[model samples]
Target: MSLKQSPCKDEIIAEAKRLGFYKIGFAKVRSVEKASASQYADWISVGCHGEMSYLDRYHDVRNNPQQLLPSAKTIIVCAASYYPAKKQSIELPQIATYALGRDYHEVLRERLMLLADFVGGETRVCVDTAPLRERYWAVQAGVGFVGRNSQLIIPDAGSYFFLGEILTSIEFPADTPLTQSCLECGRCVDSCPGNAIIGNGAIDARRCLSYLTIEYKGDFPEGFSLGNRLYGCDECQAVCPHNSTPIFTSIPDFEPSDELLSLDKKTISELTPELFSMIFRHSAIKRTKLMGLLRNLKALD
Candidate 1:
C-alpha cells in the first residue's frame, strides 16, 4: 500500500467505522505518564501480573509506543464491542463475554491492516500481542475511560469492546481525551467474585478469576473459589452501570455460536478434547485449551 504522509483524521475515522469498529480516535505518540509507569512497575514488582511473565518482560517498550514502531507520529486507536446479541442463560456455567466470539486478535488485526492500507503509511498493527499499554492509549485517544474494573469503558457502549491500535509515521490531528471518569460507584469492586479488584483500575491477577482461569497454569490454589466460572468471570462488568444498557455490537464475527450458547454444566463436564477443539477452533477461549477448561470446571463441583 502507498504511504500517506499526511493522513486525514476524518478519513481514518470514517474508514474505521466502515470496518465494523464502533469508536476510533487518533493520538500523538508519546511516553506514558510517569505515575502510570511507576504504578505498573510497582504492580510488577509486587507480582500482580501473577503467572503472566510476559507482562514482566516489557517495561520500556510498553512505556514507549515509538519503540514498537519507529518514528510513529500518530496512534490510531479503535474499539470493537463484542457484546453478544444472544447471551447464555444464567443457569449455564460462565465464560467471559469477550471470549465468546472468534479470536479478536485475528479479527481486529485483519481489519486494522485494511484500515492501515487506506491511510497508507509505515504502520504497525497492535491487537493485544504488543507490549504497548492499550487501555491507556484508548483513553488518550478519547475512545473511552478506564473503569475501576480495569476495562476501558466506552460511553453507552460499555466495556465489552476489544481495542486495537495503528502506530504510523503519518501525523494527524490528535483528539481530546474524555475528561470524565467512571462514576466511582464501587459496584465493580464490590461485585468481583474473587475480590481481585483493587481500587484505581488495578487488579490482583493472582486472585483474579480471569487470570486464574486463563493465565495460571498449575492446579487451583488452596482455599480458592471459582464461583461457577467455567472459563472466565464477568461479575464486575455485569454490575457496572455503564454496561446496564450496553450498546450491543453490530459485528457478526463477534456473535456467539450455537455450540457456545448451548454450553451448560452437563456439556462442559462431558466435553471431550475433540468437542473442545471443534467448539473453540476459532475462539479466544482456545487459549485455555482443553485441560485448562476442564480443570476450571473442577472448581464448580
Candidate 2:
C-alpha cells in the first residue's frame, strides 16, 4: 500500500464525524494475543456461545484481521448512538433499544462506505454480522472499553449504540486503548433476569434472553421465561451505570418509527404475515422472521 496518496487517520475521523458517527478511532491491524483471545477460547470450550456455530466456523478470521483482509494495514472503528428518550410502554412486550430503529447494519453501511472511499484502496465495511472481533477492536481504538456485559461502553455516550468498522490497505496511526474499563459494579449480572452473565466477560448464551429471542433457532428451552420481550432483551443494558446519562442519537436514520415504538404485545400477537413483512421490511427484526417472532410472542403467553 502506497502512503503518499492515502489520507491520515485524523482526516478520516473528520469525515466520520461529518457523517454523524458518535465515536471514532483507528488501530493498526494486529493479532488478538491477550486475555480476550483466551477468554474467547474458554467461552467456546464451555459452550457459552450456544447454538451460534458460525462463531466456531470463523474462529480464525475473527481473531486475526489479516485473514479477513490480507492487505489491510489499518482499521477505523466507529460507533453511532441509538438511544432514544422515548421508550415503549411497559404494557408492551419490549424490543431492544438498538432494534427499535431502522436496521443499524444498513444505516452504518452507507456512512462507512463513504469513509472507506475517502481512505482509498481496497476496503471492507463490517457491521455486526462479520466474524470480526468488533468490541475488541473498539477498545484497541480507544473508543471505549469492554464492559462486563461484553458491550463497548463509550464513557460519555454510553453503551446504547451500534459499532461499525472500515478495513483498508491505507496505514494510519493507531490510537492507544482507553484506561477506562467497566465500573465492575456487577449491576449487569444482577439485573439479568435470565442469569446469563457468567462472569469473566462471558455469557451463557443458552440462558441469554437476547440470544433466545433472536439468534437461537431451536425450541424455547422449557421453564425459561422471556419476561414480556417480544423480540430482543435489554435488561442488562437498561441497568448499566454508563447508560444512565442517556446520550440520545441525532442521526435521522436511527430514529424509530411510530409503529415500532408503540407496538404492544396485543399488536404483536395479532400480527399477520403481510403486516409483519410490511412493517419490518428493512428492520433488523426481519432476521428473526415472522414465524420466529410469533414463536417469541408465544413464549410471552
Candidate 3:
C-alpha cells in the first residue's frame, strides 16, 4: 500500500540524510515473497551458498520478519554508500570498496542507532550479519531494485552502498517499490571472472569471486585464478553502466586509511598477525582473518 508519506517520513529522511545515509525508505513487515524466498532456497539446495551454511541454518528466520522481531511493524532500510573518494592503486592487491574503511557493522550501527533513538521506539538493528534478505527489503522500502550483480542498485546512486535495517514496533506508511530494473546490458555477467553473476539477479556463490575470497573458507580448485585480488572482488559492479558516476560516500568512516592505501604485493607478503590485527582491527577485512587472507594471497601467486 502506497500511503502518502507524512511529516514523520520527511523528518526521518532529513535526519537519516543528515547522518550520512544515502537513502532511507520504509517498508511494512510481511513474509518474504514466495518466489524470492523459493529462489533463495533453490540457490542453497544446489549448494550455491558454498560454505555459508548459515543461510540454511536460519532458513525460517531469514524468510520471515516476525521471527526476528515479533512486534516489528515497520522496517527502516538505510543505505550507506562506501564508494571511496579515492581508490587504491591498481598495482596493489585489491580490496572491495566497502572494506576500504572501518568495519561497516560498527560504522552503520553507531549511526543507525542514532536514527533509532530519534524515531523513539522499541527497535532492533540488523546489519549484514542478520538473517534478513536485506536487498529485498531495500526494494520493498523503495530504496532501489536489485541489480544483475545481485547488489542493490539505487538509481543514479550506484551499488557501492551498504544496507542496514531497523525493525520498529512503530508503524510508518510503507513506500512503493521502484518499477525500474538495471539496463539490459550484460556487461556485469560477462565481466565476472568466475561467471558468478548468473544474470537473473541470482549469484552462484560457489563460482563467485567475492564468495570464494571472503566467505568460503575452503581451498580453491586446482588451476583456479585468484587474479590480483587480496580479499574480495568487484568485477561485476565495476563494469556496470550504473556505476559510471558513483555517488561517492559522504561517510568519513568509509575513507581508506593510509595503511590500506599502501597495501600491495610487498605488504601482503609481509602480512604478519601483528600487522593484520593492528591494521584491520576495525576493518571488515578481519572477516577472513590473517590465515584466510594469506591463503587467498598464495592462490593469487
User: TM-score, each model?
Assistant: 0.95, 0.94, 0.95
Q: How many collisions between residues are there in candidate 1?
A: 1
Rank by lDDT, highest first: 3, 1, 2
Off by over 4 Å in 3: 1-7
Quantify all predictions' global Cα lDDT against the true fold.
0.88, 0.86, 0.89
The C-alpha stretches of model 1 lying farther than 4 A from their native spots are 1-7
Candidate 1 vs. true structure, TM-score:
0.95
Worst window of 10 by summed lDDT in candidate 1:
1-10
Candidate 3 accuracy as TM-score: 0.95
Q: Residue by residue across 1-301, what tens digits does model 1's lDDT show?
A: 6343655788778888899999998899999999999988999999889989999887889999999998799999999888888888877888888888888988899999999888876889999999999998988899999888898998877898899999988888899987678988998888887789987899999889889999998998666668778888888888999988887777888889898998988888898999889988999999999899888888874
**Residue-level lDDT tens digits of model 3 in 213-297:** 9998888778777898888998889999999999988999999999899887778779889999999999999999998898888
Give the per-residue lDDT of model 2 (tens digit) for 36-153. Answer: 7888988899888888888877778888997888999888899988887677887788888888888988989999999888889889999888889998899899999888888889
The total number of steric clashes, by the backbone 3 Å criterion, in model 3 comes to 0
